[model samples]
Target: MNGANLTLEVLKRYGVDTVFGYPGGAIMPLYDALYDSEVKHYLCRHEQGAAFSALGYAKASGKVGVCFATSGPGVTNLITGLADATADSVPVVAITGQVASPLMGTDAFQEIDVVGLSLAVTKHSFQVTEIEELESTLHKAFEIATSGRPGAVIVDIPKDLQLAEASSKPVLVETQELPVAQTDSIEKANQLLRHASKPVLYVGGGVSLGNAVEELRFFVQSTGLPSVSTLKGLGALDPQDHGYLGMIGMHGTKASNLAVQECDLLIAVGARFDDRVTGKLDEFAPRAKVIHFDVDPAEVSKLRPADVTVLGDFKKSLPKLTTEVDFSVWRKKCIELSEETGFKYLANANNPTGNIDPTSMLNELSQLMEQTSVITTDVGQHQMWVAQHMKFAEPRNLLTSGALGTMGFGLPAAIGAQMSRPDDCVIAVSGDGSFMMNVQELGTIKRFNLPVKILLIDNTKLGMVRQWQRLFFDKRFSETDLSDNPDFLQLAQAFDIQAETISQPGEVTGALQRMVKSENAYLLHVRINEDQNVWPLVPPNTANQAMLEG
Candidate 1:
């Protein structure tokens, strides 16, 4: 078998049944092998879309996502997605085709130093020059990506290697073993939980990635502690659960921020103290003694110093720390704060003015959709609205660009989410600015006949940037206006997809219902007020408690 066939076999052995990518000259050999393989290859409009789609697949399915690209620009196009995945800790394996081995350092056409370029963004990378090492290299790449704080991994294979004959049989790769937290450390954490009068649980995306949702839920329930999640950590506990105080951070809920600030003991589970979460680090959780639990030892004490560090898998460690705490008074205070500061959508039901509020539309859509429906979003005010308003029943149901905050992530991510969960409804909530970034992917949706629903919140300006300017920059606005936007409904129709426009308050529910009920791809373009801004935002360099409310 040639190297290309062997590589495909190895991927199949690793249980990768689907991949997303665009074809290029250098990767043609692998494409030829893909033609007859059982693996399904999705042809994305751009390499960035392919990479983000793969990331969405992994985030939604809890499996390693795979993508392919050719040399140079093909590889370069994937950088943003790679960085986004790495920052968010999503497991993805990107395979890129390189020029022939003989062309090394000769500046061949379409040749670039992919290994070096991807070094900082990837968890690990390999450039395979020898045909014999192809299988093992691919195996290691998969293992590295899926294990130990999952992140993107890269394998760059030259064209000659793809064409070269290999005689070795594909071997099964063993999964890497992760370290467990020390027994004494677990005991210490338990002791801390047992003794604290005011304890809070801080959750992050690692809870879902570690498959520790049940463990975390049990920990919160047993302790009767108030819990708050990071943006990526939303849905780790049911949003409806009384224990959950919603997301905590710059745009976090008032209850969560207040709880974090007042707690005497903060149990951080699988969450890093990201700067956004710990605004003005010195003042964050000022009175709290932290018990930080994480799978990555490097993340411990990398930001805020922890009183006690539990270094191991959260799935294993969370179950072991089973001490209950009594914080009923504290919990009551948190619930009261939540009720006082929670987002309140305006009653647009019978408004005389024909303005459709984005928040109200999101709330109505969330109520209408099934509990298992997956929602993806592009980075903007709309993304925050969904995070705050939408109810997610499962951790995997909420997929968005969290760490990197990539704008063009919604539509492609919805494509991947729908592909991964064909029976469930998948919605991509995007802003006008973000939707246009990779709006070309509508073509991919049309070709695949994907039943992905797009909720385009058109405000005719960069909503988040405009809000920042309005609040902090004296409303200078700068280049944030997008008044000349194209007709999005017509754009979707041009891709052979059904489309609808809703500008009035009463039109939202029916339009969303029609879009959701459609058997094929559909787009619902919503015209919202351009001056709308995400509320309860904690301005830059401010304490989380000092949130700016409308």
Candidate 2:
């Protein structure tokens, strides 16, 4: 086999059945090789969308996703998606074409240093120069991407390398170990728990990586601990569980933030204390004894120092910790907090302020879709609203660019989700600003005839930024307005997709129901008033009681 064919063969052995990418000069030889291969490749409108689609596939399917791009702009466009994957620890393999090794630093046509640029964002990266190293390099990339807290791995293959022949045999790759958290420190954490009056469990993306949703549930159930989750940790606990506190941090619920503030022992599980989660680090959980547990040692004490730190995978540690800890007293405390807080959403709450209420729409959506429909969201007010309102009973039900918070993420992600689970219903909730960023992916969805439903919340402005401006910058608005959206109904129709426009509270349920039940891909343009904002927002560094009520 030629070098390009060999690379394709390696991918086939790895069980990579699908790929997303765009063809260009340096990557053309691989594309030609792909033609003779069995793998299915979807030609995305932009390289960025391709990367994000790969991410969506990985996040939803719980497997490594593959995407390829040409050199220069194509390679550069994938950086944001790579950064997002790394931050969330999603297993994604990104392959980009580069100029031949002979032109390494000469600024050859379409040449760019993708390895250097992607190094920090990726768990590991490589520039494969030798044909003999191709098989080994590809093997290691998958291993690194899937082992440990799974993260993105970038492999840059030069144009010349793709056409070269090598006599080297394929090499087998082995993972040395799954990243393990130290168990020696569990005793110290237990000591703190024993003495604590009020303790809280803060879960994050690591819990998802551990695939310990049931383990977390078992531990929480056994102890009855009130829990708060980072955005990435949503669905780690059953949203319907009474003991599960709502999400914590910037967009966190009122009761959850206040619970964190009042706790005597803060048990942070599989979570990094991000600045967004702990604004004004010195003042965060100041009086509590924090026990940090995570897969990555670097995450421990990186932001807030942990009184007790356990470095290991949550899956291994959680089951062991559950066996050793006694939570009868903890369960009683959690029950009291859950009852006192009554964090359940009240749909009829007074909203006399006249802003377009996104929560209302979210509640409507929740009512309309089944618990089985997998939902994806773009990062914005709508995303937070959905997180707060939608009830996720299953693992990996709600997919988003939580860690990276990428704006143009939903449509492509929806495409990937639909492709990954063709039998299941998939929905992408997007705001006008976010939808426009990658609305072109609508073509991809329509072309594939995937039954992915897109609910476009057309608020005519950047709602999240508008809210921030309202609170922080005296409502100056600035460049938050978005006035140039294509007539979405016509655009969808142009692509032969079923489309509808919905306005008013009375129409929301019927419109969503029709869209969700459609056999073909559909677009629902929800014309919400432009001035809406997400509510129950915990102002930066303020007490949770000071939450903004929409």
Candidate 3:
């Protein structure tokens, strides 16, 4: 068999049944092989869309997602998505076609030093120089991407290699045994948990990335610790659990940030102290002794120093850290704080614009969406609103651009997620500005007849930047207005999608219900006031406790 066919065989062996990409000249050989191959490829309008779709598929399904691109611009276009994958630690393998082997350094047409460009964004990048190295390199790409902490990997193959004769069995790369936390460290953490009157469990995206959600839930249940999650860690703990205090960060809940500040013990599991979560580096969790748990040692004590660290797979370490504790008073305090400071959408406490409140609408959406459904969000006020108001059963059920905060992520991610789990409802909740970023992906949805629902929150402005300017920059709102946004309902209709618009407060439920119940692709265009801002925000350089709730 030739290299192109063998490449497909290797992917099939790795259980990669679907991929996303746009075809180009350098990649045409593989595309030709793909015509008759068992693997399925979903053509995206742009290479960036393909990359995000691959990431979304991997994130939503907990499997290695694959994407393909040609040399030069095709490979360059994928950089943002790859950077997002690296930042978020999602497992994805990207294959790019390169100029012929002989054209190296000669600057042939469509030639690019993609391997050099990818180094900053990917866990590893491999450029195949020989047909003999192709199969093993592909296997190694998958292995490195999925092994510790999960990350994106890239493989660049020259056009000549695709036509070169090849012979190699599909070989699997072996992973080193994951380290267990030292017994003394586990004992140290247990001791901290046992004697502390006030302890808070700090969770992060690493919990779900390590496939330790069940283990984390078990530990939380056994200890009954008051818990708070990072943005990416939202669904790792059961949202319905009384102990869970919702997301804790710049735009996190008041109860969560306040509890973390007041706690005596902060048990950080699978979490790095990101600046967004920590606010002011010196003032965060000032009263707490930290127990840090993570798969990567580099992240441990990288920001906030830990009193004790459990480094290894969370599946093993989380179970060992479970301890008996009595913090009934602290738990009651936290619950009271939640009741006092939790989202009061009914009161219209923050915005008085007399328009449909996105917070209330999303809260209702949380109730109406199925437990297994996936909700992807673009970055802005709506993203934070979804994070603040909605509930998720698993981290996979809520796919957001956490670390990278990339715009145009929602729609393509929704496409990938819906393709990955066709039986489950997938919704792309996008802002007017963000929706326009990858509006072309609507073609992919219409072409595939995908049943993905779109919730376009139109406020006629770049909401988040406008909010920051309004509060921090003396209301000098320059270039944030998007009043020129095209008619969304007509745009969806242009793509042959069913569409409707809703602006009144009473129209939210019916629109959501109809979108959820639709068997075909549907768009729910929602209009809201332009001045609304996400509440409970920790202003720049301030402590998490110094939140502005207006």
Candidate with top lDDT is: 3
- The positional error of residue 132 in candidate 3, measured at the CA in angstroms, is 0.5
TM values, all candidates: 0.98, 0.94, 0.98
For model 1, the superposed segments whose C-alpha errors exceed 4 Å read: 170-174
How many pairs of residues collide in model 1?
A: 0
Worst lDDT run of 10 residues, candidate 3, spans 345-354
Clash pairs (backbone) in predicted model 2: 180-312, 181-311, 181-312, 181-313, 182-311
State the displacement of the C-alpha of residue 252, model 1, in Å, after optimal TM-score superposition. 0.9
Worst 10 residues of 1 by lDDT: 344-353
Clash list (residue pairs), candidate 1? none
Candidate 2: deviation at residue 205, Å?
1.1
Against the unseen true structure, what C-alpha lDDT does each candidate score? 0.89, 0.82, 0.91
Q: Model 3: what TM-score?
A: 0.98
- The residue-by-residue lDDT of candidate 1 on 1-66, one tens digit each, is 888888888888879999999989888899999999999999999999999899888888988889
- Each model's Cα RMSD: 1.2, 2.5, 1.7
Encode model 2's per-residue lDDT on 1-550: one tens digit a residue.
Answer: 7778888888888898999999899888799999978989988888888988998888888878899999999988888888988988899999888887888799989888887788889999989978889889999999999987788999999989998885558477787586565557876776777777778899887887888888888888777777888888888887766767788877777667777887888999888888778766777877889999877778888988899987776677776664345555755665566577544543423445433356776776777778778899998989998888777776577888887789999999888777777788899999999998998887798778788899888888998999899989998999998877778999999889999997665666667779988999989888887766677777887655456776
